[model samples]
Target: MFKRILSGLLLAAAVHGLTITKPASADSKLHEADVKWQTVVNNGDLMPTAACQADAANCRTFNSYNQPSLNAKKRVVFRARSKGGKGGEPVHGVYTKDMSQAGPIVRVLDRDTEVPQPNNLSAVFIEPPSFPRIDSVTDMIATRGNHKPVWEYTLADGSDTKVGTTGIYTNPFGPLITGASKLGAVNEFAFFEVPEFPGTPFDVFPGSPAVTQGSTIVFKGNYTVNQIGKTGVYYRDLKNQSLMGAAGGGEKAAVLIANNTHTLIPGTQTVFGSTAPPSAAKRQAVFAGFDNEENPSLGGIYLAQLKPYPISKQPMLKTLVSIGSQVPEEPKDTRFNRLGEGVSFDGRYVAFWGAWGDENKIVRLYCPKEGNKDRSAYCMSAASGSSQDAVGWYQDKSVPINQGLFLHDINTGETVRIARTVTDFSDFVYWNFSGRSPGAGEGEEGDEDGEFARWRSASFLAVSSQIKRSKDDTPYQVAFKARTGALDTNNTYQNPVDGIYLKNRSEKSPFATLIQTGMDGTAFDPKAVFVDEDTGVSVVLPVTEMGLERDGFRNGRLAINASMGTEEAGWAGIYLGEFR
Candidate 1:
């Protein structure tokens, strides 16, 4: 399907000549190959810079306007002239260097330029692929006989030197360089082709060459010729290293690879593979739903149960709940309906909650098993018509209810109000608060105002402001830990920066706070909250504005946001924290 879509798009463009400026066949060929010589140059845009004039005084030009560095040294030094007035310039030039021959200095004319002429001259480096913001510059050195001339540069500390020469030489990845040279005194510059790996192409997707638990692996393979009909996800086992499961019909769909102990619903499209769970209790779980139509509808979440005996047999899938629909008696005053959903640590309960249009409408539901007939749903609201949202779970027993907190007993199907009504929760405002039952273990400690401190055995909570005070309205973030009701209402933590917030387990003074300010338009948002079971240290994973929207430490190494860079949409990644 991907190939067909790409082919159709390309064929339509070819037939209609849809582009505004059509290039010659030769130019098209060059563009396809990224060939530099075939690029059309606009004479009006060409202006000589100081580096092009050979005068150091004139070269005080802004580095942006200088000929781009094509080598590693990042030194910009090259000039070229063309016969045709509007013709493109050749990216090569000659330079003179004095070398030590015995004790005497010898002035030698050299071809120090290392640009990939004609083939890659049209290439522009907005940022080095590996190093962002660093520009590669152009430089030339002397050629010795048939061998490319080598240029030497001293390190920044001046204690070490590195040498690079012109002519084709294999680079760090074994790419043959058509031309090359050294840049400045500290940088190494070279232009080389991307080498094709031999043998079974090293699978870039399944980076480790084997499938394992907790790995978001990608399977990549190359064919000498393109296969038209064969496409979809295929898997191989680590022990046998043999093809196991194959799901067809969709492009870019994900296979939730889990052990055999996991369950699935019946009649759902899924591919089964042979792999025993770590224990007799564990099963592999995979998410395999595809919507191909342009306006295809979203399917509800499904639970699949895997059987160990027949590895090729499809798993059993049980429909849990639909995200597209709202509860039947949902209040109309609330702008949004559903809040958030997650499974319990024991995977025995799937909990969900959301705010109705009105402040008085708060609903919570629990699905205990795949198709339990006795399961039921419930709603909770504040008497003052205050809005509510669920944050997360406190322990295996209680789940965090927004606006007002509630305690529930899963075994008895009973719930009891744990805290007083949150009076200050408004649309634009948020209040930070923490609460715990009287006999809970030592709470995670933190500062009183939720600024900083560690709680020993408590839980922390934060709330946003309801009102918009100014154009740059500072979002109020308050935190507190208490044994019963809300924390100190007067000392709410407020900051214009969105990232920083406070956490506490009990109403007692907080031990520490988490705060982060945006730099250069980058802001962070806290994602997950973790309270140390032993030390009372509260850890959080916050989403940064950079590459990984969600990042946090757990144990020590960072965990990837499974939703990141995957076909699954709208899933924010999860981050774990380290002990230290």
Candidate 2:
């Protein structure tokens, strides 16, 4: 699951030119990690004075691109905004850092670059596994305003050697699903490839799906007639252009959830296909129903199991979670919206918003625990005054729901108040204070019985978990961090550049906002530091003199957006910082 660190003096004592050692405590070995923040691309770096109209005043870099990508080599790639635009054009150039030690910027494409479709050039995502196979210009998925986006890796290389396009989807009823009908009603390609995990075997499968017959594309096909439309999760085999799910604008297929795939997994080949039963170890998707109907046909969540490659059949859909099963978990007949499902890496569990209202409530183990009477507790109220840590010697007074991230287990229906959040949330931000068993593949937290079980926000980056204690031979509430939107303003806390947190589980509540900020003794507060709870090993990121901001964490890298300041002061720029 994650790498581990040792508890000992980082540096061995050298007494009189002789190496010496001493037995030290765990805290004694804790240290900080380096956070190297570099301004990957700024107006000063890219939109230089020469690029402007002879420095006729302030020539700011108009940056429409905020999401930056980092490959295995740590090379940065992002879209840059142009000074001017023509027609419906949006993004400027696809750029990357020069591989040299003093990495310079390199523009891959200009604002007026020719595209296959009438799309507003948005952002480029590097397919790391596909990058090396090709040339300097990596293989990537370029998403724009259009439904039929061009994922042409050959085009991304900037060699002027055109290869392919996602030819607009053809509809059997009238004509085709073009980019023009985007009235919240268009068949749009949402994601191109499966998301990458640290240990996942593959990232992207570079292919000529037309000739090779192996390309896979997931899209949201919306069917509209007289202001009425039905959208559903669509699967397309890029080779022959076959379809799955309700792409034909079928009756009842009203909406398709974009982010229904599991964390770090893109799920299956077919959205609805016939495949052999999947083992629990394999990756599967727990998505909201495809057809919006009252019947159980498309009720709560359906599991899409993957089939072997060259599979052109529709995926086998099983009711992973049913709306009927979920209705009982609601607050005593309180009407609620059908929550989308959040699948755990382990196929057995699914998390979702149990109930939403004044209180961001959750329901876990609605039925009963592994060994318990029927109609037991639905929520974690019993643990309300107790510590979930196995040996629960202390009672946690209460955790407010205003800024908390809760998880609802669909299987056992046991509720765990994972995080009492504070600050805000950042995307793709992840941290491992004390890591897991060596080479373990996402084993359940507290799987070691007395060991702590790690729980995390299924949708966001906020995280919480149990703690293993050595003395008691049982796990305890050690520490947890919740991403929040606001903090105790009465406490006079500064706004966090990165809105994630880490708090000790022992404290009744979070005392201060646990993020690194305003310590550089400068006006530009760009330092985004992540402090590990157990070791106190802080990863301090580099803060440029100019104001810097980030939208969210992309995996482990911080892509600098607008923190606080103008473009001339380095607002519209691309900054990349690795949290080692």
Candidate 3:
């Protein structure tokens, strides 16, 4: 598994000039290869910022960190947001950094911490609204707790646990069969009162919670029960910490795999009108639903398998890539019109995010000159303006989107298309705010407090079908993040190269830009120091954002969240890389 976790590590040869800086920069052949680049916490790096409890903002450092994850002993964990906190309320945390230790970045929960359980019922944490999951082999973290459910912890015995809960779960561990009362009310981490529909509770938990390597806890439960609402996809084994689903507690704590009443729609009998939110490995799980709900393009991408527990029947789903089918290299029948709730499983490779035809292309949406109504003043006077003047003047004409990046080999069904959007990418997806939706407020398009507009996209494909290359066994390997297009320069769409790539189907070299972003920031932190935080002058910047998620890859290591190309304020943070 992952090469026996690096069985006797000491292997390097795959170096191909990509300069982490020292002269070397003609794009360092596209920047970075033998790897080894570490800096897991940047943006000035001081620490402990999150205020709201009062008195804690001398204006520290770190103000952003993204999804991150990684395990197999390189331990990374992420989801941050700090930077000077005088109780103006934006601390938010979930840190952990130990790329094999020199230590110090720890905090597994913040926003004021404190949520031990319902016992004294004091409840504390109010900020982890998503993205946090570690445990590739027990680094244990699984998050989701803006105020009440899915949590796991145990970063060396800080021991948290509330594996999945919501409304009424009195079983802090006491009775079940014989007499039922240490104070009763069992259903162990009940996830909003689910006990096979007894009184009905599932009020909402629409995804973000998938921690497998034996600690199980895959989730996606939803609302309404007697009034009907439906929507499901669950699993809760918490590896012996409790809620193993029903033996002595006899109330069915979790196990429901797929529910839109009864799960169908594999090839297409239809039924599940809503699913998404899943991604487990080795014990199987992989999702993205919609069975019509009046045509969500028909929806696809399945796979279930998962058996164990007192459960029986119902689990074998399979599908893989659906929405109308066909779509392989495209141009003949070109099917798959769309499919992306997210999927990135690595049990045997899945990495999804598809789209096939008809969105009418035409994207020219660049920006970097806030304030002063200038429509790029004639492409910034035919490219003579330079100073980071990216203004391209919004031309999305209200709607038209396209995306691609696929790879599915469940063994051999084969799918492969890794990167697209005008071909090889002009952005394979990135959205902290894309307008008209997410939380849109000001002129009121959306995304302010409605949160969730942040995206690195396509669930951040990180595939690994056993990562072989054992000299040509070449099974697979992938890592992604795009923005390149115009056929990689020569056709130049202006600024068309922002990377983080690596592809190795045994490497004939179709991909390997290990993180290029306008090049030279010490090739990516040799000693870094790219000022201009306000013309303190010495500038270089480059990296305009890069985050990767599918747990940010493992064993060969990857964890990133770059950013630099600043509006000012200490570049940006978190980096790791490794892979030799």
Candidate 4:
């Protein structure tokens, strides 16, 4: 394991801290890696300007699950979306993260393909690709023909030997596949039909199809157990391409993994659903979702896991700091109930977002103590000068109010905030989408339909608030604000904390050493890339100015700014961070 020398150093720093610990290594220095961005494609290459203006549906780049992974060629894989879902035109494409292998972008398949593919499609993976981990690989879930999901994988045992330059392998798409059959075609008895026998992965009818042998396509669609009487939740097999909780046991499909029931409380309209694209690989699927009400305060961000088989062995589901869900430590702190976006890889740490208001009516920092569950039940104040009791907590009126990114260890019950809204980070994150020519968008706001965000690897996330106008006809200056191009660089505004914010999260506490600060005696826009140093998470290298622009945020605000869904929803350019 990597040395744990940092923890003791952190405790001592809190005794003489500026809220954030000081950085002691080169890796912790802001922009330590000189994180520069490399742009991809001309803005016009996305979708037509008229199309986006016509409706948000017409101009989606369909870029989802954007964490780059190599194909057999080692090129980055991403989705090109249009109107998505069952018939959306989300074509898969590839290129280099640095655009070094530059050429025309390669489309995996489209209507013009030899087989003439469908229009609607989305590419979501259970595991993500990142830097510093070169020899690693992951599995992917993509559209064979929009929603007819197929698995694109590599052989784990190297069982499928690759032939020389000819680019042929014994198993091109790897084994455990049934070749790629549609949902209905696989099981003659339909997934939701009554099971001829229970406790098995098969049906009971004589005409039921055989246990799909080749590769079968799966669908993550809506299903109901009317006869058994169930309302919400779904359980689908990641490997075998099958659906569960349909035939037997009226058990609520409302579970995450095995038996880790989230605060899902028996039965309540405390609504919950997958809030972000899920990350998956071999036997595990790491994901985030939320339980909410009309009042934002009643909802919370949560992290959960799902296993392909024997679904009972699900990993634990931790409340990664539920906003609306009362904190077990401070049950009486009822005013702050909330939630947010998140990501995970290989079931490591589940990092998410959350926020709570304060009576201070201003932004501030609050640290907690792992006291003897019996120590004074108050938040630690910096005063008593020691983290031994409720003395390490303090508020700085200069900071923004509530909201922050957090990480939770599924294996361990530890959770910590990487940065707080308006304090450590500005709420208004930024991004670039060279698709939309600049005008038209925003019917509603939310990250529900792959709109406002993109999770790169489990440790990195890029978030944006609204959009802005084109300055100098260049994509780099598209400032994000409630109004078009309202950001005045000359003014020292407190700002709503909006703009593109790249958060490098970890399950560990603040670093023991702080990065260098700006002239104002503060560090704004510090770059960080969190990788597991050994048994826990730590910053390996500080990235420069929030990383690249992979995809558009949700389709919303003052004309095509950012969110998650619809790639061409705004006039912007896509860039990959130079993480050297």
| Every model's TM-score | 0.24, 0.40, 0.34, 0.41
For candidate 4, lDDT tens digit of each residue in 1-580? 1233444323333442312432323223223322333344323354323345577765545333233322212233333333343455333332223244655554443333322111012222211111101011322223222122222223565553211100000111332122112222123213322122121121111000101111111112222232331122223432322223211211122122311123342234454532333433223344344443223433343344443344433355445445554433233664344454334332334445455655323323333233112122222323322233243443332221455555555555665545553334434222221111112121111111122221111123322211133222211111112101122332222222122323332213232221121110112212222234565654322111122221212111101111211121212223333211
Q: How far out, in Å, is residue 440 in model 1? A: 58
Whichever of 1 and 4 has more lDDT, that candidate is 4
Residue 263 lDDT in candidate 4 = 31
Give candidate 1 regions above 4 Å deviation: 1-236, 240-282, 286-298, 306-310, 325-515, 519-580
Specify the highest-TM-score model's number.
4
Count of clashes, each model: 96, 24, 11, 75
Cα lDDT listed for each candidate: 0.22, 0.29, 0.57, 0.28
Deviation (Å) of 494 in candidate 1: 17
- The weakest ten consecutive residues by lDDT in model 3 span 5-14
Worst lDDT 10-window in candidate 4: 203-212
- Residue 365 lDDT in model 1? 24
Best by lDDT: 3
RMSD to native for every prediction?
28.5, 19.8, 22.3, 20.4
Candidate 3 C-alpha lDDT tens digits along 403-435: 677888887788877656654555565533221
